[model samples]
Target chain A: MINFEEELKRFFPSLEIEDSEEAIYRQDMTDAADLLLGVIREDYAGYSETPTE
Target chain B: MICFRCGAPLSESDFCNACGVDVRRYKKIVYAANSCYNDGLERACVRDLSGAEHSLKQCLKLNKNHIEARNLLGLVYFETGETAAALTQWVISKNISGTNNLADEYIDRFQSNQSRVETMSTTLKKFNKGLELAQGGSFDLSIIQLRKVLSMNPKYVQAHNLLALLYFERGDFEKARREIDRTLDIDRGNITALRYLNEVNAHLGIPDDKNSKGIRIFDNPSAQVIRSGNETLIQPLNDREPLGLGAFIQIGLGVLIGLAITYFLVVPAKERAAQEAANAELYAYGETIDEKNATISELESRVSALEQNNITLSDSLAQYEGSNGAVDANNYLISAAMAYIDPNQDATQVSEYLELIGDDYVETSSSYEFKELYTYLLNDIGDSVAQNYYDTGLSYFNNGDYTLAISYLSKAYMYNANNDNALYYLAMSYYESGDISTATDKLNTLIESFPTSSLVDKARQRLDEMSY
Candidate 1:
């Protein structure tokens, strides 16, 4: 699985992506997971993605 | 002496040493005149108008043939509003230099406004006298004088219009109507008179006929009494059908009887049906609200339980100390809790969850968790609350909406006092809006307070660029 830091670097170009130890340790995996869930919930509510019948 | 052709300083001699020009008798006089001219130019550069005038005058006094000194002295007088002096000096300079261009330009500009100045002064005197007479309650006399002014200057629309208003105030409708008609004749679409004409016709109960160009002068006392009183004078619909008091009483009684039958028979049934429908709607609304409240409470309790489980998993991860799998599991649980406290899903609920999480984090000394929870809490409160203004401002700034960004950023700065991000964005917005001084002050404050921020280098660069 892609790391939270890598996912964030892919989405946000304005954020600086450095390979410092602090960057690796402060990855905030929970925030990443929360953002993913929010996107999924929005897609479901807007009917952009539907469950198979 | 050194020659004027070579631009060399002179000595007390009969000829120029550098350029070989014969400057025998006039060399000393020309040199003194040039020095005075240079001194006047310097004073003019510093905006010392009086000193510049004195120096230029001295230059001309030393050498009456110095045309440049005379021209510059004319400019000084013109700048000081002494138009006559300036014209005289320029005419003399033109004679000395044998050039009509500069003197003619000054004379042309001055002569264009001379007639207009005389007319404006006369009009001002008459307007002031009219005002004094009107203030002393001499309304008819004021109107008469204003009419004379209109006759002299037939296009004086304000005089005709004001005289009409004064006559109207004095209750002389014939005179008022005549003056208003004159005003409208001069300017065909006078909105003021048109509006006053409507009021006059409504008061007199007279239908305005388009073919009548002359003012209607009525001597009928009944029309005058109805015009002056506050009584409603409804015109007769037809000449053959005159209205009587007995017919009015019969019509009023018929309306009263019809209203009584509708109130006694038709309204009770409609009122009963409306009451029943309203009660049924209220019952359904109450049930729905109650169901929603219960569901929300249940969801809240489940979220609290999940949070407790996450806390237990975090404790377990701490006990295991270096177990990667346990830490990953703990991270997933916390992420789920974060998603449950989403801001976009009902902000009030999200705010409640964040408040609870903030309290827990504060008690546990979890500063990292506290910061994340606080940030989310601020965002959930939205721009209506000042704490969320910075986040909203950032969203606007990123969208290139500089005006809205400045509005929200100013509110955020008022709330938090030390929000460097809001201050920086506010300055940028102000700079984009062409407010340079406010932008400079904000940038100065940010540089002083947030030197270690990521935007510090950019702010410093902008400050340097703006300093010049």
Candidate 2:
């Protein structure tokens, strides 16, 4: 038998039109490519920070 | 594609040509995003909106700057009736690619009709409310709210799944199956709809397809598992052999209950209908009686009015036959005319008939012809009628019958005003009748009116004697 309470918990409230602006503002736009670029930039900064090589 | 380091284009090598930076991983990420976008496009074309949404979101996670994947995700969201979510994706897509972007067109189309936006807003609000109600354990109210939401936006997969879940919870397996079927029609690979369909199918005793996708999303513990030679045979424990005697007895009890229901519900309904029909007929009869009574009263009033009219007409006829009435006066004139026309009839007969036509009738009447005719007849017999009256009055006066004398003398004087003999006798009759005042008046009239006559001196002598 379907546990109605357990099943109902899966459904979340749909976003309303008024909340769309806030949702868009709070969205995480960071992607895998951005993470890769962040790693590469950190590596370049670390190399420049090291003593003369 | 542009390099992240210096905004320079890349080459076939593992590095950006202008920036001299490694771009092999970045190119792999772009290629992976492109591959995901291709998969999503294929899934969307096949109407697998749920699969498409997964692929498109994966593409966006790999490369958020993928405009095509982002636009497709918005379309998938719009198709599923998540307008605000779709608009969020499109708005982000447009911000990333300001010009020559498909998101611009999508946003323009969505925002063109103000009423459509308002309707979608209402649909979303109702769906959220339904979800809230469901979470609060008000399943029935949630079902009603979700039904309204689906009526406004039928492609809303979330609302359909929620409504189907509600039906399943309420044990309405057939209705739950229908809502799930509608949800699957919109989003074929929807996991929620598939799960609900599985539950509904199990409740309805429909055999589940072994190879169907998402069929085993929820495990049914009531099924007995039997393993035989690398194959598992699952049998539902609830499917039982029928109880021969107990089932028959239950069927018999159901038939008896049906008959009882027929007797309790149907029989009274038929009797009430009969009673209502009888009451309606009685009310109609009463209305007809009231209408007939109204007609009778109207006719009675008409008859009463006619009776009053008849009485007024009778009174009018009686007035015409009275002493001074027009009918009586007309008859007297007609009689005088008839007597005057007869050769054997004496002037006395015509004169008496003319006297019957009262002086008031001749003077006050409107008929000129009647007055002219009466005057002509009176003048024709005036001299003889006056002489006869004067002789009768003189005889009556000498016989001491002053009343008789006065009556005849009055007529004689009325017919011929110039008759001195009639005037003298009329005055003498009044003197003998104990009317001294009237006698004096007549004597003075004779003296003033006929000064040259021998009766004038006699009249003056009578007047002087009356004064003494």
- How does chain B score by TM in each prediction? 0.22, 0.47
Weakest lDDT window of 10 consecutive positions for candidate 2 chain B: B209-218
Clashing pairs in 1: B1-B15, B1-B16
The candidates score, on chain A by TM-score, as follows 0.32, 0.81
Chain A, model 2: TM: 0.81
Q: Model 1 segments beyond 4 Å from truth?
A: A1-53, B1-25, B115-468
Q: Which ten residues in a row have the lowest lDDT in candidate 1 chain B?
A: B223-232
Cα lDDT tens digits for candidate 2, B53-157:
999999999999999999999999999999999999999999999989999999999899999999999999999998988888888898899989999999999
A1-53 per-residue lDDT for model 2 (tens digits): 67888888888888888999999999999998899999888878856633242
| Runs of candidate 2 exceeding 4 Å displacement | A48-53, B210-468
Query: What is the TM-score (0 to 1) of chain A in model 1?
Result: 0.32
Q: DockQ for model 2?
A: 0.40
Best by lDDT: 2
Tens-digit lDDT string for candidate 1 (B1-468): 334445476677665566544455446556777899999888776755556788887777656656777777877755533333565666665555666556667656755897744443344356446655766667767766776656545655456656666766767666767766665555444555565565555454444543443333345422322222212233333245437987788899999999998898879889988999999999999999999999999999999999999999888765443233434433443553565566555544443344333333333434456457555555545433456778898788888898999988986885466678889999998888878899999998898889888878888888888888
Q: What is the alpha-carbon lDDT of model 1 when measured against the actual structure?
A: 0.61
Q: What is the lDDT of residue B159 in candidate 1?
A: 61
Model 2 chain A weakest lDDT span, ten residues long: A44-53
Query: Which DockQ-derived CAPRI band holds candidate 1?
Result: incorrect
Report, for all candidates in order, the number of backbone clashes: 2, 0
